[model samples]
Target: MDDPYKLHATAMPLEQRRAALTALAGKIRSGGTELGWQVTWNVDYGDFTWLIGGHINNIGDPFDDNEFSSETKAVERAVLDYFAELWGIPPPHDPQDRNSYWGFLLTMGASEGNIYGLWNARDYFLGKDLLLPEHSSGDGVEPREPVLLYSVESHYSVGKTAHVLLLETPADVGARRYPGQCPIEGEWPQGVPATGGGSGPGTIDVHALRALVEFFAARHHPVIVVLNAGTTFKGACDDIAAVNEILAECYSATTGPSWQTRPGNGGRPDRRSWYWIHVDGALGAAYLPFFAMAPERADLESGIPVPAFDFAVPGVCSMVVSAHKWIGSPWPGGVYLTRNRYRMRPPPFPEYVGSADTMLAGSRNGQTAVVMWDFLARNSYETQTTEAVTALRLARYTEAKLTALQHNSDHVPDLWVGRSPWSLSIRFRRPAQDIVDEFGLSGMRVQVQGADRAYVHLYIMRDTPRDRIDALIRRLAEPGAF
Candidate 1:
């Protein structure tokens, strides 16, 4: 048979195309149980099939009405409002109100949101009047150069954003391309190092972070810190509240040249300090609130502690969450939420798009908003909280099962089964290649007791249940499976 995945200049027969698509769908369905990534496969988008064929683009800000009538801005706004309520922010009453929440749908997942947040932070620290560029000419006290700081466990997007924005780092200062770009005049890691000695496996040490911030603040440099609500590999969350406390202390102690103390453009207020706190909550942000709301629920009594990472925390300026991770979207998409006061006043409205281009992407995916709205509408708060608790329970079950298997004398030895508190992922000894491929497991190598050991993790998403975990255990029990 000809390869169904191959494409040619000549069009295939209609019957052949149908058969090829059917075969591909069958393969996906057959392997659905083995999907180990963060993506949730228990979603049904049958009701949205009709809207898929239309070219509905959400052009600009969700709250602002644009001339593009074919967009789904209303639905997008509803989605943002839902998240605002979840993340403890007041919904926007008016588009121009600075106190209300402001945000937009992202077409390119959390990476786009991360980039957007970092860009806003960089510009905000630079004191550039984005709304009126003409009035920003050498105004007020010269703003201190901003330095980028993030945990070593942060998503690769944070570092990539720093490189793209040309933001200074301790390691990149004396390099070949841009010399002396970093203002910090001492040794520092490119990324803030994570905590060691098993206090918090993948979380950043707040003390170390405070020391670093003090070092930078003393040198008259503004700071931008990216906190992770859920790390990629270990699924650990940083203590955002503690970090906020550190920022408050630093703010009180530091006496530096003020950046936004004088109104340069748009009559902005007198802000004494320059700092930005962004949370990359691609996984945890989507469900942690639900966990917090229903901590006493029967199934969620696993003793896993939930950390706060939302607008309620005073220092958090911006946050992003992936729809595909916990909310189960078909494609990579998300929502970026921040207060309207913190939003960078967008450049003059573009007449071509017929709306103010406040978001990162001009032509956003309208169908994504519909899909997210559908999911949220179909699932109530109670339903979502139950589902979140179920996922956590399954993760605990997997960890317990794997630990049992490790202790079994006839089965694998030195399994190194481990899981973090409130994490939906379990890490253990790497199984054979066939098992890894069949289960869609992700592998990593780390130093264990001073010896390098191979590890693989399984994420307990919405669709992953005990039966699937049992099947994985059965495969590992086979002779020489590891």
Candidate 2:
């Protein structure tokens, strides 16, 4: 009989695990694996070596700081400045915002970065302008609500901020667009209600976003539009420029008989009509410089490019990217960059600039800041192109395999490639819950999420291998694993 706890009974000692993993190295290759995500939970991090969990491949972890040195701080600033120069912008500001907070800072992940963008956006729209009545004093200004609008495809952090940040914020704000962030568990709701029965802007379509912006502007509300540069699971980007143009056009619309027009002939534009677009680029933003230089290959879904999202785009206000995922940077590591440094739409600062906080995560790893610079300095187009091509090959390969499985198994639905070149998802005929649990046991983890139960995602790379990937596919296709 099996032991009381099969896994514990079968646990491999550290030395044994090292040996087993050392032997498996030949079988594993980056971007070719079922083992890549597995390695995430396996590899542990200490010193410069990353050998977390059960996985024991010693990937170098450059995002560490062990000392307090002015020279190192200077190096980080210089490197960040260098990156900012690459963007054709002023040098990146220190997180301390010494000179200005108008640029970028390293983050723990794109999720935290998105939260940060929303927090700033909320202040810009509601708090800073005396939009809230309590802040408006002798000016006789009544506090008004700032509405946050985004496609459902936008990062969850937006919603988190809506409930988590704005709820604490003094301004009364609500989320519009498709999926409203109003509390589902509570009563009377809060903020703005969705216009189209909350079906959400369908499929990141720009037209839907345009219509929503117009509807809200008609109410004279301050608005901020968030665009998904790299949606979590699907990896698609919203057409940002088109969305901006739509909001701008609506802002200029002058109609509504003689009465509907405001005191200034209603032709006077609502400065608040100027909407912001913060790209939630968790998995994709770091490769933007690469995309900016080489648009042809980079624009492809399987290639790395900033094509549809970035600060380079005229209207994009802010963006975030995850270093922990593709870059192998340690946890709680993400970054945010913004073109607007001084424009605050929220409270506490009527004349707003960037936050004094270096990151939304305060007292953060100054060490990671140095290492992030190192990664960027060492990151080259050549390495990215190689990684992109490999990831694409595996994604395309898995697509074919999963598609064939669908034909044979009626339960397995259509398995499609993700929106990004570097990511892919597989949909099975069976329930995603079962699939999730099965993968857990095998240490071949994937996600069964993204607002759909039928389609499950199998992200490739980091440290996974082709053999494990094949094994996962085979097991999934078999009768029992489902």
TM-score versus the correct structure, for each prediction? 0.90, 0.64
CA lDDT for candidate 2: 0.49
Off by over 4 Å in 2: 1-72, 82-101, 104-107, 127-144, 167-203, 254-273, 288-306, 343-362, 408-452
* Local accuracy of candidate 2 as per-residue lDDT tens digits, 1-482: 63322345666677766766775665443323333241232233354442232222101111223332322344545555654554445665543342232533454567776777777676655434312111211221222455677655555577777788753211233323323432332222332222222222213655445545565556555467777654555555566667766766775572121111121112221232245677776665554445445435544454434455655566676767666666665555656666434244322321222223233543344454555666666767667656655654676677677667767886654544233433433323333455555453222223333343334456555354567668778876766554
Looking at candidate 1, the ten consecutive residues that score lowest on lDDT are 130-139
In order, candidate lDDTs are 0.79, 0.49
Query: Among these predicted structures, which one has the highest lDDT?
Result: 1
- lDDT of the structure predicted as candidate 1: 0.79
Q: Give the least accurate 10-residue stretch of model 2, judged by summed lDDT.
A: 257-266
